[model samples]
Target: MSSNAEIKISGFPEDDGYWFVKWIDEFRLPHLTTSSASVKVVLQKLGSVDFHNLNNLGSTDIRSILGQRKKDADVIIEIRCPVVMPGTLPLVFIGAIYQRGVYVGRLPTRRRTIALADGGQEGFELSLSQQITPPPGWPEGAPYSLLNRFEYSVIPNIMRSSRCLMINRGEDTFIIPRMTIFKTFYAPHTELAKAFCGGPWNDRLDEVICLDDFESGLKTQKITHPEQWNIILQVRVPDVFAPLLACFTLMSSQDRALL
Candidate 1:
């Protein structure tokens, strides 16, 4: 992969997190940016998670790779704080946003940031900013559509292994992840899809911006840890994210069946 292809990550802009969370009309839409069968929607949770190995931890394979664990491959997330879904983590790189092209979610890190070595002890960490929930109606204070439903969790300590961020949460051998979410207004047409882009919470300004035209926040994750915290980012197409999403179809049953 070229330097540019290596995906650039960015944090919420100091000026206004909206820039980091809202939708961008100018960015190029993905060439194949529709929810297709072979697609996957990449989302975030917190800390670093590996996609290829999950069996070690016994976590099930998340159909919605955007927020859950994967089968066979183990995922580990280390952090200082909780992983607030649909708030801290915004609409990142939407693979379905482009048709064969790619949307880049970048993190223009601060100077003097040291890189973590593979399987290194010191993992990654970032601050968990705000947790804004809009009152009843969405932005413009309109009624909320109920076509597509959404829900997410707060991940206390999710990780692959060895590499992780942490906090002394007592002797709770297993860390519980907290989840929150917003279901989309599902209509086959993109016009209906627009409503799902985002809305305001508690009557606050609908300042959350989507990363791209076709991109929207189905869920968000803001994580904190000693050395590193923040959602583990996944870049994928929406269709591919459906199973993980559990909106259209709940994966718990599927997972039980698998087990």
Candidate 2:
């Protein structure tokens, strides 16, 4: 078996202000990590956003940010500055995501709730109430296979400047700690005890970058390089939200010239 399960994601130009995201996963291999047998999923072509247009339009038009719209695209990411202070003119940035013809959620500097685009508030609560199964085809008897899907909820910390986002399953909860060293901001590994060994703190995942060029606005690759756009995810985990987290990270990275 291969050492990693790779997923390819591509999209429009980063200079256009919006990205058209799509991902493909065959689940052909299993990546053995400290916590579980995970897969490496890479999200490439995280297109850039032109802040120039936002000034002219007076509002961030996400749908036209890519210049041309692909109605079938999986997800769309848009960056906007909703608030500004005397010295912090346009410093605060928020990312808005749209998928399946509806608004998915917003990623802000402070903690906030995420509502599914298609599902209303009731559907959002329902997903958290039940235990979600992982994608099929893992060795059925392994202990890690029993890991439940986590529902990420943002809890506001009234006393602190930034709120806390919690990932919970059953009675266990893991708080997503923030790291500013990446310049892009990233959430270090907190899946299990073993995952803490080599992460952003130790510089294992910080240096990684996407190397492939996106002249075509979209393309697919069979292999992934550590220097290029790639992601490592726990096997059979919540596949839907992984990319969302990745995009949120990229929105702050120096690679996109943001925050």
Candidate 3:
């Protein structure tokens, strides 16, 4: 989960330009308030262009003119920004440039999105190879034996991996994701009722960082936000049938016919 990669800047001529952008905030919007985030901004600047010329690039519409200044020979502008990647919330920008404040070419800030520990690429790193412990009564390899086959995988947010399909023998086995989501600045356990515990807000995020270090025999952890919050463990097991016993039943004929 390398969020702060090279402090990048696009749109401006990569060859030459004096773009001075600094992240002074050690723990905030610009500096990442939590350990899970790393802030980086892409400063867009075209040489000597008026505000009207500095369009969003995607839109053909022009901006209204005011007192524009080219005071600095090099355009000594400072944009303290960060690349925000909230946990579980997939990265989506319906519009370009951050539209929070007066987006006078405020520039779109691309956030680094970290998946929920189980439902994301970073989810399996910690949970995989860790070995799934069977129920207290089952033997070490009993779960594997009971089932025809078992496996796990990581599913990216872009992919729609859910509990929709049924797993047929030797078929329909999608990626099994296990996520550990860190919930920082989270409300106290008492305040959250049981119904709210497993809900989306249970891990209502502060920040999220993806790490490939987990399950790789290494301890590189992906962090996402500003606070030292704990993770709510959620397991997305492979779509497999759970073994169960049923005695003499009237639906036997129907079950056989369906099968």
- Greater-TM-score candidate between 1 and 3: 3
Query: Which scores greater on TM-score, model 1 or model 2?
Result: 2
Per-residue alpha-carbon lDDT of model 2 for 1-259, expressed as tens digits? 1111221112212242232222111112222333222211112222334332333432224333322324524444332211111111111112433222122333222344544343321221121122344445745663221122121111111112222234454454433322112112332222221222233423332323232456865422223455443344345223443563455333445534422
State how far residue 170 of model 1 sits from its true place (Å): 12
What does the lDDT read for residue 91 in candidate 2?
15
14-109: candidate 3 lDDT, tens digit per residue: 443323221111112322354343323333332334333444533212111111224323433333233433321122111222222212232223
Reference-based TM-score, model 1: 0.17
Query: After aligning candidate 2 to the native by TM-score, how far in Å is the CA of 185 from where it should be?
Result: 19
With candidate 2 superimposed using the best TM-score fit, by how many Å does residue 103's alpha carbon deviate from the native?
Answer: 24
Number of clashes recorded per candidate: 80, 12, 23
lDDT of 1 by residue, 1-259 (tens): 1122433233222221111111111211222454221111223332123222332323232323323333413544211211112211233322111111223233222233334344333322221222223334557654321111121122212211111132222342111111111222232222222323323222211122112322454333322445321221124223333333233222245553442
In model 1, the runs with Cα more than 4 Å from the true position are 1-5, 11-171, 179-197, 200-238, 244-246, 249-259
